[model samples]
Target: MVTRTARHGSDDESGDADYGHLQLTALDGWRGFVAEMHTAPNLLPTAVWTGLAEDKRDYYDDDRIDHHSRLLVVQTPTIRQVIASGRRLVQLNRNAHSGRCGLMVSGPAGTGKTTALTQLGKTVEVIHRRRHPHAADDIPLVYITIAPAATPKMIAMEFARFFDLPISRRANITDIADAVCGVSRDARVTLVAVDELHNLNTRTRTRAGADASDTLKYFSERTPATCTYAGTSLERTGLLSGTRGEQIAGRFEHGPHRSVQPGPTMDRAHRRLGRQSATTPAPAWITARARPLPAQAHPRK
Candidate 1:
């Protein structure tokens, strides 16, 4: 499945693709990130021949180095499954009142948990756009991270900030919550991703922690969006401990993540990397091309 020879779409031919970082939590930022996309670059020329200018050859070398450094994301099954499930859940929860289901993605580092989380958001936004082409102002999704040692008001402020709704310094939790819910409803948002949720483990046992959990519960109940929480090893973190934990566990559908194992998936990933290295005439090849040849170097051949 690693098509090293495959060329990407004509859109990428421009080579000015803008997938730059946008303030993902903000409405404009989220839309900007979703609208701008990038895919794998076409395979660079493999052989050095006569007549291709040195500057152009150097350009090819530079392009390959830049892309390889960033690396390509293999579209694994787990990521595809999560994107599909998240899309379905949003539609399923659109009309539900209470007991609306949510998603939980948990694993250790390097598992691509956050990557899958954002891909789901992108998929949801794309589908929404197809359905409502004229609704340019419809935000459809909001993403934010859970701050450590965060209180009830602090939690409310996170959501409010995403909408860029100015919150007065004297505002209460109620004031902020009202603004977030109202703006999200108007934007017709149906999905929300909250990352770094494992940070909540520290606040799980205290009054502030309990209230923080309650604050999230209240928002989920009030907001129509299908919420998703992604973190690392949630079961071990005490995030799902006690009454608050029980509430979250009961409402959320737990999905376990798998690390890459020794198999075709691993083999394919390795092959792709090797193919990329060979195709671009990797750094070693570039250096050899630059250095002088010895007396033994064949000229007649």
Candidate 2:
């Protein structure tokens, strides 16, 4: 997402620092964002915050929010698995000729599909940065989101936008696709990520989805990258069902980022809780802290 720098008035009292317009799809923006992600925000404890004067807390409060935001995404097991599989695949497909195997992360929305996928890219990108610290032009990852009702040209343009390729108004889909593919190849981009894959609905009769699929296929084949995707119920969307879908699925490894998992029933859980609470004795520390309430303070409910 692109955000404009906050415009502060001359008379404004709060002087919050502005981290301007972070759009990570582009190279400069992405590099800045990665740096930002690495720089964890420092927040003081509640006692320190309470001691601070109200007039000087705006900046500190903002910092606290930043710290909390960074902590929101916990690295779950599934994300770890995705990162492992993606790294392995990129290495596995490095010397492949064509029809390279890919990774697809699918589950319901809000299941960290985007998070897992982006983390995969960051993991690889970090390794590349560490290996070739001086190679600034060696961008090893590309991430783009599929817009709603996106066409083949639209998908190609997202790639062009990420690489910041110069595209004229009269340029056709082939022009954009070729430019993107050439830049990706030149940049030695090894991980190509497409988020919001659910937006590219191939069920439509206009053949736009099919064409979009072809555009993606072209990228996977033309550019030396492991194409990874994240979306909601991709199999149910019929994205991996048709002739092309079957071929794509045949070469792809599917991973589920499911939010729901089978576990002990609620009744069993309640009984377990009851048993623990009824039989367990209070700790000495808790007993020491407790005080008997007056009769007026504890009228029977």
- Give the number of the best model, judged by lDDT: 2
CA-only RMSD, every prediction: 8.2, 7.6
Candidate 2 runs further than 4 Å off: 1-21, 37-52, 260-301
Positional deviation of residue 59's Cα in model 2 after best superposition, in angstroms: 2.5
Alpha-carbon RMSD, candidate 2? 7.6
Tens digits of per-residue lDDT for model 2, 240-276: 8879889988999999885423335334544555566
Q: What TM-score does each of the candidates earn?
A: 0.74, 0.78
* Sliding window of 10 residues with minimal summed lDDT for model 2: 3-12
lDDT of 1 by residue, 233-288 (tens): 98887768888789889888887776555445455654555466557754443354
Best by TM-score: 2
Query: Candidate 1: where is the Cα deviation over 4 Å?
Result: 1-22, 39-63, 69-71, 202-205, 263-301
What lDDT score is found at residue 256 in candidate 2?
80
For candidate 1, the per-residue lDDT at 218 reads: 91
Which residue pairs in candidate 2 collide? none
